[model samples]
Target: MQKVCWPYFDPDFENLRERIYGPTCRVSIDNESMEDCTVIKVDSVNKQGLLLEMVQVLTDMNLSISKSYISSDGGWNMDVFHVKDEHGNKIRDQRVIDYIQQAIDTTRETLSSSSLSSPKAKAKVYTNSTLLSSDHYNEHTAIEMTGTDRPGLFSEISAALADLHCNIIKVHAWSHNTRLACVAYVSDQRTDTPIEDRSRLATIEDHLTMVLRAQPTTGSQRATPPNQQEVKASDLQGGEGTMTNVERRLHQLMLSVRDFDEPASESSSSPMMPMGLGPDRNGQNPRISIEEWNEKGYSAVNIKCKDRRRLMFDTVCTLTDMQYVIFHASACARAGYAYQEYFIRHIDGSALSTEGEKERVMKCLEAAIERRVCEGFRLELCANNRIGLLSDITRVLRENGLAVVRADVETQGEKAVNAFYLKDISGNEVDMEFVERIKREMGPIMLAVKDETRRQSSSEKPTMPFPSLGGFLKSRIERLSHNFVTIK
Candidate 1:
């Protein structure tokens, strides 16, 4: 008689196996491999959102990804990135290299561990803590606000905070689709510490809510009612609350307010619309399309737009936040244009099946790409750090009829380094004469203007059209098959 064979089961075997050959990550940086950019190669066990996590790290360090090749097949991921510094030069700083190595290693370890299943663990792993200043994470209070966008809006908000004896230590603000999102870090003016009083926090929230809900002087219609606008002031000094990334928080704020929806008629007339959504001289508005990859059971997303810094971060962040899993992707930027293709599916392993879903995805992607387009002249201010400095500077700007389109404020030890993109309140080019006068009055040594070349109208068309989806997939599959054979 032949006995039936039963499969052996050992509970401890799984854990032991994981210890021996589980999720492992290796990262190497090669400055010699590429002539114009540093090459970073990563090999690791495949998992959802891994690509986005890696991209976020590089972007936080202000590195520009000129080209990247990403693949995740058979439960393993291999990625290669060609990166340059903000000046479009290869990275040569040893300190930066060490930081990147450490950060990526930490990220891998965190992701491989079981703790990542929790929200707090995910937040800790993804927060931009390394790029922050030397101060402790809880040194300042975090303020998040979103409402309708208008000229001089930032000035009014800063003035209100100053009046409440709050000092702005760090701030990042962005305006898109007639909506505004701001994240500001503040401290008490007298004590130079995070504000802890509950009443004071409530007062701060109330004051800012009013400022955001106030009617616009420029006759722009409000997007939402006073009760609908969001204003929150939180003390980050204690507890286990998840610390949010400033840029990611801004993206979330804008999305929560449905900034990707069709812009109001009044918004279409704003200066930002023409530059952000209208066709450029090449007659190319951001082209984003999605099609079904039936054989692969994926949705292929293709995007073509003017290349700029942080483009990868924005798109990846949007996709990840939307609960999509990217199986393969490629990005290449050349000659002032960028082309990106992604093969993705829903987290549940389903492709986008409906027209409404595909359309929403495309609109969200467009908004994400356009949110960071600088709309006006770039202004850099370097001076001694002091209380009420931001308020004073913004007051000056408001008085000069200059509107802040985007702003980044930081404090490094005893110095303050701030940058603001400004446009005339009347939606015209900034007056150089007025800028010069303001510089003279506000200490010419402290403020400097950097002229940005305006986007000129062009009658010429694109030299080549975007590649067809069928051809792109064919090439991608061929490349992947070749890689598989070579690896074996």
Candidate 2:
């Protein structure tokens, strides 16, 4: 059995966290029955604080952390725990270790599942700045704003920033309605905006607030955003509870990933250009920026594709040319190219005057993404605010043996972007041709033909975790590791 450790063992914690209640910090978990509890071990550096956080994960997984061991080593700290619940099927089961592993993997993956992103996991995760490996970039504060979802939402914000001359650096946008208002985050490169320019920022926020509050949001989001604190600092602490043999292995893998500041540097191979991936005008700067121009529906028209130079200013120029306002931007890239996607608020509304025009715009946008966007080896297709059979898509993909590794679901109004990060069950590269094949197959499924509609109805049973993906993807990984699995 591998040893499990902790991350919440901060250096200054010991002198701060209280242990009057018997230094209860470490978390122990039983996989087979989630309720099977045991003791835990922790470190002296805020042992209680670490354990307190561990309990959250345990609770989420339906387990419990009773007692723990807390201490510190050199500069690093560690926590171990022994927990107990009424459930004891784990120790009796032969596959308990497998169950534990599944739990750990699920918990680990849960934090990053695209379906459940905090502001940072947005569809557009970049600003107009350059992508660099500098420390200053990571230290910047990140914020996200969400309200009602609708159209012209992005443009309204862009307009507000235009008034402030605050360039729209980057935008990761999501909406839940054809009429759904939207939520977007803009990062400004005005790094020198005096550390005390509190008023300036507030004025901008006020502008955005007014813009959003004035928009319409219907269906579910009409209610206030859930008050249950969708985010918590403890969630960021990672899990600190005790592990079954399986969880220990999963935990080790996760530890290795986080042990470093960045995952293995992204391979420097040519970027797989599905969207706008090509040389720009300067040939030395691939920092092309796409602006939202479709009046009724947002649009990203290809601006430039060139070389590897600082195209921050030029990127800004493209946004200005579109008569869009920049809210914020960041420095980002792919394959050493000076690449970044900007989110500007356009001045005009949807260029469409009728339903047919809007439909045409959406169809064209979908086609562009399908033919152009490829991440790693997987092609991504996003559909938002449309009601169509999603289950049939999952089944056909399963038949094709493509397992989804991650899924993120977000709703703005009637539209929800269900983003799936998938891969071939057999860990090999999935080529463009294969993606096309799936698309061709899905084309029929997307259409509600009589037979297809019947099939969609049968497959549309309320989805399981991921409807059809969770099982194949999870089990495939377990097999690749040749580990046994037990469902808890």
Candidate 3:
């Protein structure tokens, strides 16, 4: 092979002039060097999180960031880190250069798909365009989209920005084969455009949906494989949970955030896990994300419960005509912890901002779970590692006339997880201070929520369809129309 010089990433970039092509390429690396140390300045708006991922890349390249001040607004993000190699060699090596080049190349290819061949002044200037607002710019506002992942998903979105005279400062895209998930950082339109270009946005979304639908593997490309309990294809064909061809044909889709007027506590009204507390008042009103669901996309107001409640299904998915598939999903629940985590995705950005309605909506989910499982209770106490609090806990419950039925305890990740099934004399399970009592006695809790046992009555296959796909999709679209840009 002919002699070639690689890109440089070290403290001695200036001295590289003596190296082969260095005479003309005179590149000054953004590194602030110190004795036995160096700083590499990486300036890029990471929408696909190239810079963010670069932190890991640097680790793989045997580099370290001593300090970093990163900021991500809209889809564009930036991370300027001070890095150094362990050997204090100034990190001017081939592997470091290669890794940086590879990362940038991958980002370029991803951005090119959206007609963003040149990252120049596109995302930034476009965000300030006139199409979004006639009054003032909403700096904190962000754009989230989910449709059939496509090559021009970025191009079309950026084109929409261009049409609206918006500037795209930064963006992030992650694609696996045929489709992708990307976020673009944009501002108000730079040109004189109306704030009502929503029809245009809808048009772009629809077009991409059709393009994705036309692909042969669109349906199969993004499917979550059935669980161990799921029935076979033959069983699904005639089964109520199975989907018909027509029902599966959803093109590119869009679900905008609809802010609710009430507080979230009141809105999130549904039967959920007694223990799994969804986002409450303190946390940001998270966008709704339905996960591992089968043909059961939920509405915005009802979506939060899916996580905390873990409405595990034996049927289809929440979204339709998707190219991505999930194989196995297991709820990660830990007993006796402060909170249980529910991993999900609001693919369409259907339930956008949490605003004032977050707390109430979450409580609704808790109430639902409590209603279904708390009817008859059991308060069984187990041997806790923190023996001191055990007495206080039991004393509080017993003094208050709470009964203990069955209980077991085990350690999980340095904390104890206890399962208690108890009941009162009247056979009625009712205790408001149940959570408070647990905290008071065995505090520093991680998931002090409820996991009231659920009993599905009846033995016969209750419904025609194993899972209701239509019901899921119906809920997704309706909630998206409710608008609330108001943030606390």
Stretches of model 1 off by over 4 angstroms after superposition: 1-23, 93-95, 114-136, 217-219, 223-227, 230-244, 267-284, 431-446, 453-488
Q: Of models 1 and 3, which has the larger TM-score?
A: 1
RMSD (CA, Å), candidate 3 to true, equals 25.4
lDDT of 2 by residue, 14-57 (tens): 74545433332322333333454443323332311222233333
Q: Give each prediction's root-mean-square deviation over alpha carbons.
A: 14.3, 25.8, 25.4
Task: Please give the lDDT score at residue 41 for candidate 1.
Answer: 93
Per-model TM-score versus the true fold: 0.78, 0.24, 0.21
Location of the lowest summed lDDT over 10 successive residues in candidate 1: 122-131
- Local accuracy by lDDT, each model: 0.70, 0.32, 0.32
Prediction-by-prediction clash tally = 1, 84, 86
Model 2 TM-score is: 0.24
Candidate 1, residue 84: lDDT: 96
Ordering by TM-score: 1, 2, 3
Clashes of 2: 84
